[model samples]
Target: MTTIRVQQHAFDPGAEINSFCARNPTSGGVATFIGQMRDFRGPTRAEGETVAAMTLEYYPGMAERQLDDLVKQARERWPLDDVLIVHRHGPLVPGDAIVLVAAATAHRSEAFAACEFLMDWLKTQAPFWKKEATSDGATWVEAQASDDARAAKWKK
Candidate 1:
């Protein structure tokens, strides 16, 4: 089964990973990625210090649709046993896992590749917006051209 969830509360990666792998008899390998909040103080800010919090927002229905599309694409390309994606919204602090992607496959190579592919697609194409709160103030992080290029590699 494939599951995608968007929530305000935290999650247990170990539990999620275990649940994804438990019933899949055909899956021999499972790969997972967890993205965390980074304490980014922009170059212009005085005294480069840790960020206090990060606020994430997304268009509810649109974000879920986009993520489902990404997961569907992964399923079309890979012989995956299972996949799970979880992304959190609202305020978060450093070291908090922002998102999680897991892929289960018969082989490690496929599992790893699919996991990476999902993350790259999410980073570039997902409609989530992020703002960092620092001592100075809060600022939104712009999407990078590099991220677009990274996502382009997966296209046929």
Candidate 2:
């Protein structure tokens, strides 16, 4: 089974994981990754400008299609029993959940790898635009070189 959603509404990670476990009882392991909004940004992530809010934008149908395609790619590479992905757009403040990715498989290794692979792909390829607001001004977030490096490792 596969689930993909893109919306402005908030979601509960705990509940999502529990639901996934219940639905895939044959699986021995389930791995999940949750991304949250940060309050600050800097080298060491301790000092710097504080983000008041972040706005995410994406084309509705196209965004979901891209996410669904990534899930398909993950399934082709791993023996996954189930997969789930949820992403949010619009204004998000500090501590708000941004995205959730989960994978279930008969073994821990497959679950873990699929979950990580999906995240790495999403970070680099997901067609979403993000703008962060700070005391000074709001700026569009650009893709990081580190993200590209991480995603590249999955290539066969």
Each candidate's number of clashing pairs is 0, 0
Runs in model 2 with CA error above 4 Å? none
Tens digits of per-residue lDDT, candidate 2, 1-156, equal 999999899889899889989999999999999999988766555677788899998888988998999999998999889999999999898899899999999999999999999999998888889899988899998778999999999999
Cα lDDT tens digits, model 1, 6-49, are 99898887888777778776789999999987765645436566
lDDT (CA) per prediction: 0.88, 0.91
Q: After superposition, how far is residue 20 of candidate 1 from its true place, in Å?
A: 1.7
Clashing pairs in 2: none
Best of the candidates, lDDT: 2
Clashing pairs in 1: none
